[model samples]
Target: MPSLELDRYLGTWYQLAAVPQFFNLVCARDTMATYALDPQGNVSVRNRCTTWMGTPNEISGTATVNDRVTGAQLHVSFPGVPTQESLEGPTNYIVTALGDDYSWALVTDPSRLSGFVLSRTPALNEAQWQQIRTAIEAAGQSQCMYLTSPTTGGLSGIAPLCTV
Candidate 1:
């Protein structure tokens, strides 16, 4: 429910964990996303990950702000991919939680079927991780069961799974 400053939110973000998506099933490590404001005022999204086979995979998309008042909701669409009937609207993604410094963020869809824990770095401190977990639970999600920690080569301090 917190409003986000669009300018501060645009940058590279490493995916610490996520509710597994079919398209990202092959991702094994080094998952990341980058956001940039386009000339037309839309947000450009670029996501990349190291596949299980050690290959780098990537996808590009665009996001349109649906609510300027809150700056917390948007609709993201990837070209060449069929839009799901349920997500064919102005707002499909919402920033449910964001760090004070914009160093991290928790994003989810209207249905809460997909969730992502993103940060400026591949690793997060214990306190930050706890904060994200709490936010995930506050958003009506199962933090332990749903969030799957990625092996980004620096998560030794964090549990591989969200069980902790």
Candidate 2:
């Protein structure tokens, strides 16, 4: 996760899989996150998803690069959501692994409480799935904790990383 180039990482990333976060449990499918460079030198984050009732749910936040050296760690804070935003406390999102072409990435936090498999496209081939699984394991994450996130334009099966 060293030498993470933020410029290359800035873009819309589809959530192929993830460990559920309490606030996002309402989402039924099609989870997505978008990132854009802000004038404040922070990353603008916008997350969207489809709820079980077929409604769109979204939240915008600001992500500060917490790790100045590697730029892999970030502290994200939503407008009204209660979470730490201080640069020195703890990073809520960390790019633990990334694809060679930046097409996919594995992300988590210091506590490893949550994990996400993000890809440039909604769907991936078997080989890409395998790559994500390998990265998850290499990051010391439990595949059992990660479930495939069903997207309207991507994979729908609610399977575990171990089964992928």
Q: Could you say which candidate leads in lDDT?
A: 2
Query: Candidate 1 on 41-94: residue-level lDDT in tens?
Result: 888889898877989999888888888789899998887767733223668789
Candidate 1 CA-lDDT value:
0.81
Clashing pairs in 2: none
Error of 1 at 146 (Å): 2.8
lDDT of each: 0.81, 0.88
TM-score for each of the candidates: 0.89, 0.94
Tens digits of per-residue lDDT, candidate 2, 1-164, equal 87799999999999989998897888888999999999888899999999999999999888998889999998888877666444335688999999889999999999888999999999988888888888888888888899888987788878876777
Question: Which sections of candidate 2 miss by over 4 Å?
Answer: 84-88
lDDT of 2: 0.88
